[model samples]
Target: MNRSHLGVLIRMVTWPKKVVFGAFLASVLTAILGILVPWVTKSMIDSFTSHIDVTKVFLLVGLFLINVILSGIAHYMISYLGEYTIYRLREKMWAHILRLPIDYFDNNSTGQTVSRLTDDVSTLNNFVSKKVPEFISQALLVVGSIVFLFVLDWKLTLALLVMAPILTVIIVPIGRRLYTVAGETQNEMAAFVGKLSNVLAEMRLVKSYSGEKKEYTRVMESGDSLFRLNLAVAKLQSIFSPLISGTIMLMVLVLLGYGGLRMADGSLTTGAFVAIIFYIIQAITPISSVASFFTEYKATSGATKRLYEIYSLSEEKVDELDEYTNIFDGQIRFHNVSFSYNKNSKVLQDISFTAQPNQITAIVGPSGAGKTTLFHLIERMYTFDNGSISCDQLQIDQIPLSNWRKMIGYVMQDSAIMNGTIRENILYGVDDADEESMVHYTKLANAHHFISSLPEGYDTVVGERGIKLSGGQKQRIAIARAFIMNPKILLLDEATANLDSESERFVQTALVNLMKNRTTLVIAHRLSTIRNADQIVFLDAGKVTGMGRHDELMNTHRKYADFVEGQNLKMAQ
Candidate 1:
């Protein structure tokens, strides 16, 4: 809010020479044309006293019309420059947000980040494009006016300068309050957007719970807060604007009375009096523009502060090596790996295990036993606190994030599906995917038959989050996506846990095809998944309790035996 805000403003402005030069040219024309009109008016008035000069009258009228045209041109150029600046600024923010570390997203809401990127940045665009240009031309007019006023009569110019300090004393205090209010309004706006996005995304849950009134109340409170802040701004402007105008009018009245006496004594000519009136009237508009520029700048600083925090954040480290290593064929080892979210008590403690190349490593435990947290760690969605997870001989963090992630293909319990054609979903992160491979992978995943049966086949649009497709269909689509990725390490996190018996069989079959000859990690409660794992690592309260094949664990570990028996997994025998 202080000197630091200037840095944010400077960063937000984009200077394309063509646009900058155009705005500058138009601004100069606006100021020069404006300054000339009043001087032409003075000449017309003086000529009227002697004899009516038609040419002078026509010239004065023409200058006024041209001034209007120049003003319009200045506005258009400035506006174009503003929109261009915002477009580039948004591009940078979007890119930076994508590269930002996972912890940033873990701590911040999408609503707040999106609000800064879109709405808050718009506030800055308005100031830079519209307000700053106006201030510049107004500054020129004000300076030009003062220089001429001193030339006309130095005594009167000094008298007008006395008002500056009084105006400053009034504006400074209210400006601080306005800055605080503006900040609160922006924050409330972000909260409101976040709430609505969450509610709408989960609208089905809300309807089933009959919680409409509760959500309405929460949303209304945020809206009410914004309204109050906006009202405060309105009230401040109502007082701030008129108070300055009244002072300027009082100065004008004083000038008129003094000039009238001077005329009576023949000390001032009629032409000089008329000319002074013209200059003062012309000076009024730019003065108000100058005042508002300062006041509104205080408001824009709030938005600048929000964006400043985002820009200051460190991005995820990605150092691409000279070559991509085929590291997945080597075993993945967790050496005393421990982690916690927000430094709370550890979620995983001294956990160590290994998954060999091209084998199924299943993780199983009760809910809240840090089962899914294990997958998150292996994917490097979070960094562990007290240990090292390495592929081959290199620590995972030492490997470039891109290199590490490129080897992984994850399919979660709830399929991640965007609203797009099935082909697009299958080819989501894949590059240069051919139509032939698309069909081949879908066939491998057992998806080609159902897809070909659909009227549009692979071109069919899935509704948001694949809502139009059943659970098994979504799973097959995800499996097809995994197949296309051809990753070395495939992660299946309870991929078949939610499907019905019939759907589970089909999806299970597809998953077996997808997992074949890949270093696979599966987190499951399903007996079928556990029964097939080459190695089953049992986690109890974040500690490694058993590590063996399912049959070995059933004989050696009573907890594993009871857990599987409770699910009626014993009946399969």
Candidate 2:
């Protein structure tokens, strides 16, 4: 997009060291063969004027054949090497993307990220694999032609040199402008792609809301903006080829006039004049190719910027462990912890609590009272700003995230089922889980009976996000998944919320058994759900207003008492 950005691209190409070197060598060979053929052509032309020697003409023809064959081989190798290098680069870039932190994906759009991985990578691929080699070959040809022309006669070479300064005044500025436009176009295109992805992912929601016309208009507007930006870039690039060819053609005309006078004065030979003219025509190709090279470079510079932007995202921290084991003793603690999703507004403040070994701790509050946020912190989704959290006396921050997460089993209100068979979903967390244990947890979750009714049983496909199953069915399957993991600590976020009364009753019975001899934290809206909890913590506006057993809180705590009464009345109705 700018000078520094162009410099960055040049540096990017050089990263695949072997490919760049091979390209350089191939380009040199190709240019040499190209220049050699022109000399042979001149020799063959000159032979007709004199002795009419068959042997000399045949030798020139043979040399020309060798040049063509060698050029083909060099071209093939250069292109092959460049493509190979780019393939490896694409793989490496993908690997880098996969290693990035979860927060990065949370911030970026799936469409924009996918576009960068696909379109941006493709642009860079073209630049490195094809254009880079061609640019180098053309550059060599231009330089060699100029040197040879000077050796033939200095006056003609001086005439060509006069036009070189024009590049600074015209081509440089145009290239700069093209790069700027191309960069803007790429950004706009990515944004449009992002919008498209958003719409596609939420197409059901869009249709349900009856916003099709409004959404279509917004998409069309984005497309129009992209088209306009691309048109501007194309227009700038279109001006270059004709201008380059015209300048070269003008130089050719001037050379023919000036050289004729020189030949008449007997200062230049007829053979040299013809050769110089041929060189001028040949010069156009290399000069124009060099211009195309810069143009392509500018576009790819934009792509490289986008690619590097993804590569530069910070990755999650990883720690080396020589030996490690899950040592959670079914206990958890929170001491003076404070948290906020944003700096200005705290979602949790100065909260203190503990879940004893083999006990159930339920959290209940009004909506937006930070109930869900507490479970997130306990799971170490985000570290607290003040105080500490410990799992069986181990500070969470000291242990690796992977190890810490493995010790806890979580079942949320919305069932997250990946696209896979029932068996795979049930054992997603464990490696090579035993079938005996699998059947055990499925029965415990009240899912085995329903799954057996399916034609495929445990092998039935869940489809995307478990769309194949009903709400209550999906929830049971999720519970079964978490149940099979056999985690030391269990976190349930309204686990039975999706079920009908019958399903909820069944799931509640399963949960009561599952909570036995484990540290259980439950976030509940229904008083019936948390009525039997060993300890109930009542939250309101980021503050813990009450803490006790459900009956104790209902009797003594005003907020908990109101919540239970309201829920009971709703259930009664």
Candidate 3:
């Protein structure tokens, strides 16, 4: 492992230092007791050949019982400590993930991120909690067994030493291969999970478009890739386990043969031979543990690298400024502001506009003309490259991100609604909203009537993304959500785009209610929706071509006039 991985290990271990240390000490004591058991048994065998006292026999049995009980206690504590540590680490990792910038989510898949938090963290947790104690105990046993072997006969100890290099030669290359395969398996598993999540989320679309066979084929392909990678890892383990076990058996056979010759010459006692054989078996157990440790270490290193990559990302900074409280005067200005999702191509170029207090500013544009991007910029979801955006003459960047967002309400094109009760979804961000306020806002959005008509009334559950609600009902609920915020600025992006004429009429009325006495920015798809806008900013190819009242732009700009005429003709048809 490198310094960084070692550092991560140290930090995790030290998080619950007292518990970890206690577990480590208990493991060491258990290993010492294990080493003492063989010596006691050898003494008992010699005593049986001579004279066996009843008290001595009982005392020996008691010591063995004590060893077993102590070992069990130590094992239990180690397990407990390991679980507690894993819980704390996972919580910290999850909190960090939640606070990450919006752009990070744009580039990474939700499934992959979930895999790291669940699968990868579990891998690390297993190593830290189970393997670490086991490795330490095994190391102590190996050393203690070797010391006893040398005491019995140095020549026999030297003979067993010959097997160490042979074991290393067999284990090292296979261990490296196992590590490589383990990493590939994890990556494949993450991809499979990502694909599964995407398919499940879009199941409605799949059935609607009759793409079930295509989706099934795609899922099966991902599953096959994961299966193959896992099989490769299993194959390497199959080779490794037998090679290490066979080598240990071979050493034991050689020891038995050599000890028999010595015994015939009266050079070794039966008790000594028995003890040496027991010690050799004890030594071999740790050798197997060491092998397993190497394999686990390699796999854990890969997981550690993935987690560190996420931890290394810079978090979005929000400075605390007492001058900018959670309030906006509803005056917004963009002064030659420019931005791009990728810096190579500008999405919003040199854009300048002012949304006056208590007035409606409608942004009209072609599909790729950066209408939604403007809302993203205002929310500071993505930072701009040049110029500035100010609210009430105060630079937006100087305000706290939380305070800035709190002062504005947003209603998206899809009318995003989380899975919850009608009341719960409406009061999502505004937890302090009273029952009276909720009812008033819902009524204003024309959602209260439908909600009251439901069997459960305000308590009715909306399935995932409000799937139970119609498009218009979802829009009204969203509008009610924005209404409850009572924000100084309201952003409406295609608020009435997906509704039927009657639904549109209700949503449009709710929107007009929401816009009362607040600076509002509307991204309109149907030109008629924004016909009464205080100012219409016409955009094409990421630049503003005209800004004025709708009627003025209809006569002054040919592109605007052409857009209006086309919409009117479509309405007539």
Q: What TM-score goes with each of the models?
A: 0.92, 0.89, 0.92
Model 3 Cα shift for residue 345 (angstroms): 1.2
Q: Assess candidate 3 and give its TM-score to the true structure.
A: 0.92
Report how far residue 395 has shifted in candidate 1, in Å.
Answer: 1.9
Residue-level lDDT tens digits of model 3 in 280-388: 8889877988878878887777656667677667877744435548554679999999999989999999999999987889998777999999999999999999999
Stretches of candidate 2 exceeding 4 Å from the true structure: 1-22, 52-73, 80-86, 319-322, 434-436, 456-459, 512-517, 568-573
Sort every candidate by TM-score, greatest first: 1, 3, 2
Stretches of model 1 off by over 4 angstroms after superposition: 1-3, 9-14, 43-69, 318-330, 500-510, 571-573
Structural RMSD, model 1: 2.6
Off by over 4 Å in 3: 1-14, 53-56, 318-324, 498-513, 568-573
lDDT for residue 163 in candidate 2, whole number 0-100: 84
**52: Cα error in model 3, Å:** 1.3
lDDT per residue as tens, model 1, 360-404? 899988778898888888878888889999888788887788877
Report, for every candidate in turn, its global Cα lDDT versus the true structure.
0.81, 0.78, 0.82
RMSD in order of candidates: 2.6, 3.2, 2.8
